[model samples]
Target: MKKAVLINDTTYDYHHGCEAVVSGIKSSLLVRGVEVIASCPVGVHYKKMNNIEKAIQQSDLIVVNGEGTIHHGREKAKWLLEVSAYAKKYNTPSVLINATYQDNPAEFDKLLNDFDLVYVRESESYDYLKQRGIEAGFAPDLTMLLSQTISLPEYQSRNGIGITDSPKVQEGMWNFQMAMKHGWTFLPVLRSYRAEGEKSATEVLRHLKHLFTNIGWINKENGVSEESYLRARNRFLCYTVSEYLKKVSGLQILLASRFHSLCFAIVTETPFLATSGNSYKVEGLLRDVGLSSRICELSDFDDIADYNAYSFSDEEKIKIKEYKKSSLIKINNMFDKLVGLTG
Candidate 1:
């Protein structure tokens, strides 16, 4: 079996979205008979460089989960640079998977050039890597590929809605604020996984306490049992924010702040609208789907009813299905090409 090492510093403790992304990458690789070993930047602090070095020595390929570096921050940029340098040392078939586009330092650019295959989720991102002269291709998000496995329960009730910690909400309140405009009861599901002394959690909890009467906060501080995790998996509606689309399949509409939430919405065939978070990549992905109107910028929500004026007809439904099919075909083909699985 070809051995592969998955590198991502993301954990499920707080970022459930990343947790799902990692899970999707691993699950997909496993199905192809790839012996997969996973590691994160946090491991570097404890196991030291020797741990990743040893894995690199034994692996046939190195897959870097690039979502960790989309933001404009020193720490994220540094992490990308360090990981790239380490991966290059092995001369393995290194692939940067599901990364968003971001401006980085010269060293970061140099590190990107070292990849054997670079798969981005957006065409704009494909253009980005090509501009930098990195061998790149576009693939739908791995999360979108895995969402196909979701079997939604019959939504027997319309009691609640869900949203994630997106700073953009304060600006684009129409999607969440104007819920009554479309005759659906909006129940906001708010979750927090902040560690002790984190003010952001406290602030979000305070605001959400008023916005949502029903909360689904998963406290990793309490720790997650195997049973709880399984139960969470079964309850499609209570899926992590990205999985929200699957859970709310029966709802008339979904409005969200997170990227995966919109993705879930499409996968579940649920009518949904979203406000862009701090990430422009989410906006770019939405544009690729031809649902740019679905992305309400903080500035665009000045009139929540604007979206109400748009027609939601069978034509729109056809568009959603076509988009989903096209994206999945590309994603699956990429996997086949990567593994040389041609029949």
Candidate 2:
């Protein structure tokens, strides 16, 4: 068996969207007869970890799950891309996938060439990589690969508009208020699966945060609008992946603020529109599908009726279905090339 080390195994986030990415990467490699001999989580710095070098040295492949981490040339990205340089020392092949390559330092660009393969999640990233002289494949975020395994449930009764959170906190609160003002559903898009009492310190901190945020005024950093904030946070606390998708698939339309929420919307074939997020991902993805008009701003919130009961257009439905289908096929091919399984 070809031993491989999966770096950036990001599944600590019990969020199903994140889980899908990790699962897609691992399963693709497994089917290729590659064994994940060891793995590393997202939080740790790989260079500082004493065992990382040994893991990389013993493996035939080093797979980096570059999910949203390669942009900005930050310390974390440097640590991740450095893996390619490290693997070269042992004559092992390294690959980076599901990445978003944006404005990064000119120096880090050289580090990219060492990868045997690089697959980006959006066109913008692919363009960026090509401009920098890296032969990178363009693929949608691996979360879409979930559509192949967890097929959309049979359509049944779907209810009113549902709103999800944002990378930006203020926008999240605004999302809650808008959902409440119209008596729509407030779907919390990202939540961990850990039981509440599992971590006492984390539990205590959450209680303190909730109590602190309940103090009336909408402090941009400290809090949001009145009771809606408290109520939404309480309701947002937990979900199994099954419950999360069931709720997402049942929504008539979802106004999303997070990138993964849009992925959830696509997989479930739920109607959705998205606002600006902390990164270019939302805009990049919508544009790729030729649905850039779906991008909305808070100023346009009241005018939401323009897209009421919005569903994908016949053309967009075709585009999205094809766009989504490519994710898995591309992922499988990336692995095939990695292990020389490409026929």
Candidate 3:
């Protein structure tokens, strides 16, 4: 069996960027009969550099789940360089899969310059690679690959109105209000689930006041054991808001600030207004899928309803499907290329 090592340098939230990429890698490698061993388990901090090195030594290939190399300062980038050097020392073939360089250009070039394969998640990363003379190619988020393994909610009954979160929440609500005027059930669903301590969701709700009708918050780091996860996974109303996702299935329209929340909507094929934080990673994913236009500016909050309606168009919806398809194809090709390298 082809043993692969996946390094997930992230806090094990319920759903995170690295976890998502790892999921994609797992699915792709499974198809090619490869076994993967992630160095850090979910919710476990990876402080042991020795363990990561050992995993790399035992594997036929190494995959650094894309979350860019460094951020804030150069601390994470430093760690990444250490790991990359270790991989090179052992001659372990490494693949940087689905990464977003949310870092300084100089730093990104330095960290990503030496790699067997670098699968970029956005055009910016690809262009950056070109400028720096690094071997890199653009690919979509692994969440798109979920299309094959997961069943999304069917668009069985799309209510005329769709409510979203962020400042653009008003736009979705206004549309829903219009639909409600015609006798429809119009409710705006907002979810908040960061590793933030208790009451984060409540705080957001309090801030939103009466704008949001449905609110859900989940802090996954609190309890994420095998049994706890299973229970949370199986619970009808896990974390208070999962019920909405479970009930709405495919028909719920989401306007979200969180990445995984948006990802949940994508896996469900539920149309949404992805409220981008101050991060290029989100925008990169949106651009890859041709849905960049669906994002709303924070400044648009005052007249969110108007802004959402003004900016969102039929063209954006058409691009969603196209981006999804292209993302999957790009990732599949990356996997095929990596598998060939190992063989």
lDDT of 3 by residue, 91-199 (tens): 8887777666654546656666557787877786677567667778877667666666554444355443233322243444343333333332333333233222435
Q: Evaluated with lDDT, which candidate comes out highest?
A: 2
Query: Could you tell me how far off, in angstroms, the CA of residue 335 lies in candidate 3 after the best superposition?
Result: 1.0
Q: What is residue 242's positional error in candidate 1, in angstroms?
A: 9.7
lDDT of 1 by residue, 282-319 (tens): 77777787777777655443343443343356877787
Off by over 4 Å in 2: 194-234, 306-309, 341-343
- Per-candidate Cα lDDT values, in order, are 0.58, 0.74, 0.56
How far off is residue 195 in model 1, in Å? 17
List TM-scores for all candidates, in order: 0.71, 0.85, 0.68
Clashing pairs in 2: none
Q: What overall lDDT, based on C-alpha atoms, would model 1 receive against the true structure?
A: 0.58
For all predictions, the C-alpha RMSD in Å is 8.8, 4.4, 9.4
Q: Candidate 3 has which clashing residue pairs, if any?
A: 164-255, 165-255, 171-305
